[model samples]
Target: MSKPRKPKGRPISGWLILDKPLDFGSTEAVSKIKWLFKAQKAGHAGTLDPLASGMLPIALGDATKTVPYVMDGRKIYEFTVAWGEERSTDDLEGVVIRSSTERPTEEAIRALLPKYTGVISQVPPQFSAIKIDGERAYDLAREGETLEIPAREVEVFRLSLIGCTPHLAHFEIECGKGTYVRSLARDMGRDLGCFGHIASLRRTFVAPFGEEDMVSLADLVALERVGDEGERLAALDDYLIETGEALSGLPHIAISDDQAQRLKMGNPIILRGRDAPLATPEAYATARGKLVAIGEVAEGEFRPKRVFANH
Candidate 1:
């Protein structure tokens, strides 16, 4: 018997703030959502480990262009650190390399928060996706190769001790790009002399989105399973946020349809006359409230860098 052909997804667009469940990798979640929506193109704003869960912003079609903005935005996470074991991977998934009976007092843990907040150097865990010599650091570590991953600066906006016990400490942290929670746990452990590792992690939100914006995969799957193709697509649309919403962080300039056409055609629009607002370094140009393009505004000219396909 011949194998059946795989169904090709439709030309769908916009974003899905998926409430990724624990144990589902970011890539797998993106694939599932893409299939559910039958999208033509898909990508995610950030990578979330299988061990972590919560708001994973998946971008479909033109929405992918705005992924960089969301990725660069701050992230908030609530995680638990089991304070007696140190692991090779810096999380529960790895082998325990050391055990400790030491546990810091609540006051002690809180005192260390200031030390980690703001710009601080962090050495990523050996078992991580970071590339070294074109090979994944985790792959190298699994092969028993020792790696000296250099410490780099990362920003932690806020770090708070939420709750704690003799063996477990819970924390909520808001951080900027390149900040690794696993590394934070490892260093916090060393600083406390308790040798802890991440036990559980849940990303509450990524900037431009929050927990309120998230929809669980099971909810989308339930909608898809119960209806015909037409109805399924309609139901899915209820959750698909508009692509323009992702660019909300940037200042928007409403241009004339003619200006939008010129911008789309890769021609600079002269921002002269009374209607033109003062130029910003960069801005999103919209025509009748629809995103036309993203561009640099210099000396009264809108120079298109990334143009969006008008729907």
Candidate 2:
């Protein structure tokens, strides 16, 4: 039998800030966008639950190397909690296990908001992606196994009550990595004595990239359907943000071609007389405005940590 040919896409480098749609898995979204761009390699900064929607940073080619930095960036999420109901998944997607008629007053919720702020411990939802004995926690929960999800410390920069009603309340949260909006909602409901679950969730942004940079799949598909192949590709390129944008908060350093060449070969360059931006010991080095490497500076020497293959 003839060997089945492998499908290979072109090597495109950049970041695509996708405004993810509800009910679409992160993996599926990445696959669709990857196909549209015909990118050889692709990845996402973090996984957004299929039930949640908002900014999902899709990294293409060399941009994938910066996913770790993006994942560590602060995140903003605006969500709604429907009071008086508890669900197995802690979101609307699962079966409801309990309900109550009690609802927290606007004053009561506002008062409780302060308690959720700062560093706090939260137990991630059982129907989550956390691994348990080499298997996913959700897989175990789906198979009727009860799992004890430990409470871990997560930083909540700000938690504010944005709006409220008799049955539901809206909130906006700024949190560090690993915080779960569902857990916050569930805990809030419990504190109010009615029990609650996340009825709706939308991430406003994931640092560096904001709502202003987001593009929808429908819009991307429309661009792909227009004009000739080259024109379509050009249209797509217009939406792709440079990979260096992911390193926005990091320090920037301009290095000479010789330094860049040495960095590419995983060598450290001494910056004795060179003026390096010392905002942070860690910085992104560029040569002629193109990202060359991410490195650290110590004792006037720039050390290549991760070199980009964009050139």
lDDT of each: 0.89, 0.90
Write one digit per residue (lDDT tens) for candidate 1, span 76-120: 999999998889999989999988888899999999999999999
Which candidate number maximizes lDDT? 2
Q: Model 2: how large is the Cα RMSD against the reference?
A: 2.6
RMSD of each: 3.6, 2.6
- TM-score per candidate: 0.94, 0.94
lDDT of 2 by residue, 215-282 (tens): 99889988866869888988998999988889988888888898899999999887755465543567
- Candidate no. 2 TM-score: 0.94
Off by over 4 Å in 1: 1-8, 272-277
For model 2, where is the 10-residue window of minimal lDDT?
272-281
Model 2 has a clash total of 0
Query: Pairs clashing in candidate 1?
Result: none
Worst 10 residues of 1 by lDDT: 5-14
